[model samples]
Target: MDFSLSDEQRAIQDMAAKFAEREIAPHVAAYDREERFPLEIYAKMGPLGLTGGVIPEKFGGTGMDHVTYALVIMELARHCPALAGAASWASGVAGVSVLRFGSEELKQKYLVPLAQGKVPAAIALTEPHTGSDVASMRTRVIRTDEGYILRGNKIWVSMIKSCGWMIAFGTLDPALGRKGVCAFVVEPQWPGVTTVPFKNKVGFRPMETGEVAFDDVHVPASHLIGQEGEGFRVAMCSVENGRLGVAARSCGMLRGCLEEALDYIPSRQTFGEPIGNRQLIQSKITDMVVWHETARLLTLKLASLKDQGHRARQEASMAKMYASDVLMRGAEHAMQIHGAYACSDDFAVGRFWRDAKFMQVIEGTNEIHRWLIAEFALGYRR
Candidate 1:
């Protein structure tokens, strides 16, 4: 039960930390203010292998292990979760599906460019009406002599315009339920594909999240990921990676809250004395430390399980659920400690608070995870 990071892992962690402080920290406020994706920052990340840590070297990625990948995400997220998320979308969430299920031609076309950070990618499973209920998705795909014709709408798709391609899931037949699900690689520039950006998001404003409408878009046969009727499996397999990424980001957010609160506490004065002298303030700081450590450990445990090739569905849910909850609560407490200043955009704690709420909603809602954790414990699911 060795818990310490290996020398290589430590080096990678340090490198990511330096990159975040040097590259992302300076631009976070401006990007968030403008609600713009930092394409230039991502360009730098591609050359540093930050954009493709999970991908294989053969695909032009750094071929790092999952633990190292988690560490990188954690470091990047400490400064900007949006940047960490964009990196994960390209490397783990979107790229892993193609790496595992995509054909050789698909890999050569998408993964090569994705690993190089030349283009980002997106996964479109959530629809206008369906989120967790994937089987109930209204998107439909019809088989044609040329390929597949897709007609459906996907919402909350991040990096819509910037992604070179996206893996979209749709049902072949409405009556077939999950068995009818099919996944396809759809290029955003196709004739029938249209995207509408979601504006005024509470958090992750720097990310380009939007709705994508595929109106009878033609997809080449070679673009299909895995076999027909296998889209459900493809979507399910990617959850672990998605959950792990969210958990790692939550840990980083928790750390950010702790650091922000710690920095402000002593300097803040109350009753002509430092707020850090108050026991209540100290207690909140203590809770932040505990939450950060707990989240990090759970996230790392899940990452280790993945690297060992173990089935960690339950663990992934647990880590994602707990870490996100901690992030939400920690951000709240940090805000509370900051008092009126927390509400202002001048402080990072407010940003953390806004972003923390989204973590609980994305990956899987905390409510859904609670149900899953209990079901796994009761032997209702395996």
Candidate 2:
């Protein structure tokens, strides 16, 4: 089988890689340490033509393919997973949804600014009561003369503070189940909308996850994406895109672990020679290489399927599960190689370890994905 990136993909990968090393690498650690979002950097990416890679040129984007987008995400994530997460949430999840289902007016209003990095958008799915079980959400949206009135609380909403608009989900009637849900383009600055920061996060500190509360927030009719009662489908579509993004980020984390381990092994001397000479250290490093390569390939496969207009729901789950699992493994191995030093902020492995665990939890937990994969294999699901 041929395994070569297209010229466009290679160019994006190279540009992203160099940009990460030169721009992201120097400031990411400081952002993480300060637990502050790298708000300005995202806007700066617009001039580099990196902000609108997901949508078409008509929507103020370059119309880059999914595989190329994945490559760029991986490169950004190698140094700053939080920054990569923000970019993916803005471009892949929320931005793509607008491109797919939004009206021309909505596209001109929100998507164009988002593509230009003048405005950030967020996908509001997770709630305090409902995590992955989105159908059971208690947030209610009622039809009114002016428009829809939204009253709900969304927790663990990433980039909330930085986002000007939110692609939010709410249920009109709980008895209708998923059919009762609808997606709305919510203005965060509207009256009765409030946000609270999630303090002291374990990882992804620079991404700024928060809780958003909507109390009688009026949403105009023009902001509704797709038809009423189609919120579940819209949310799932965004989620599929997000799953691939997470997989790419996991691949980046694995690469970082390998690179960090390689740099440390030779310089760290044990007994009479370098620790790299030992069989155990060599074995861990070898496994890390295998994990990184395998995860990267799986991520690319998912991206390719997406570019081909395939649904990719099942394959995205598999890629996300396997890649995230590999990331956790690589982080653990890096920690073992670094020994005591891994516990301190002096090394990057500690952050990777925490972030890898977070990866498994988000974009649907690994356990949930495993069950879904099993169903797909058993011919019970498609």
Candidate 3:
């Protein structure tokens, strides 16, 4: 099988790499320290088609393939995962969901603006009590003659403050379980919607995270995505895209750790010799290299499968689980190699370490993925 990137993909990758180095790298530390979302950077990305690579050209995006989109995310993430994450959330999860399930009128009204980066998009699925158990969400929705009335609370809603619209999932009836769930597009400026931003996050500090409360918010009938009782399917479909983005970002973090360690080993000396000469150090570097390549390959494979129009749920879980695990391990090794300097803000490895740990938790935790992978392997799931 061919494993090489096409010429167009390579060019896109190079362009994204240059853009990240020029536009994102310099501001990483400041953004992290200030806990500020870089709206200006996203403004720049809008014109470059970086924020909407997965969206169709008719929707004001580049209409790029999934593999190319993955490459762009990887390059952007190499310098700043948070920036990459915001872009991914917009294009991959929120945008894709709208495009896949929304009515034509909804697409024209919301998806176009989102694709153009005229507005940001947010998804509210995880509640205060439910993290990975999306079907158990406590948010309640009632059908009305005009539309739907939603009332509930959601935590860890990313980009809530800046989002023009949010995709929120709620249950029509508590007794019906997953079958009762429904998805709606809610305008954040509505009368009953309120948000409180979280601060001092250990990782992804630059991206906004918050809790949202909807108090009988009135949503028009046109805002409902897909048919009623299809919210579970909508959430699961969007999660595959989220997992792919997470895997790509994890691979990029792994590459950053490898590069950081390699750069340090040659300059650091101990007992009158460079640490690069030590077999243990060499072994760590070797493992880092292997992990980075392996994670990247798995991520690309998943992308390719998606591009081929396959469901590929198992592949998404595997790539997301393995790549995130690799990123965590690679960050730890890089920090160990850097020693005391890693704890200091002077080195980027510390940030990578902090961010790496979060990757294992988002887009479905590694623990859940482990169970899923096993179930898939044993023919318990298909």
Q: Rate the local accuracy (lDDT) of all candidates.
A: 0.89, 0.86, 0.88
lDDT of 1: 0.89
- For model 3 the TM-score comes to 0.98
- Which tens-of-lDDT digit does each residue in 46-78 have in candidate 1? 888888878888987888888999999999999
Q: Rank candidates by lDDT, best first.
A: 1, 3, 2
Q: In model 1, which runs have C-alpha deviations exceeding 4 angstroms?
A: none
- Encode model 3's per-residue lDDT on 1-382: one tens digit a residue: 4568899889988988999999999889888889888888878887888877778898777888889989999999888998888668656668887888999988888888887777888889889998988888889999899999999999998888788999999999878889989998889999999998899999878768889999999999889998899988888877777899999999988898888898888889999999999999888899999999999999999999988988898999999999999999999999999999999997899999999999999899999999999999999999
Model 3, runs deviating above 4 Å: none
Worst 10 residues of 1 by lDDT: 86-95
lDDT of 1 at 12: 87
For model 2, which pairs clash? none
Ranking by TM-score: 1, 3, 2
Give the Cα error of residue 309 in candidate 1, in Å. 0.7
Backbone clash pairs for candidate 3 read none
Q: Model 2, range 1-382, lDDT digits (tens) per residue?
A: 2458888778888988898898888887788888888877776777666777677888887678888888888998898897677557545768877888899998999998888767778778888988978899989999998879999899998878888898989999988999999999998899989988788888878667889999999999989998899988877776668899899999998899899999888779988899999999999988999988888888888888888889888889989999999999999999999989999897889988988998999889999999999999999998
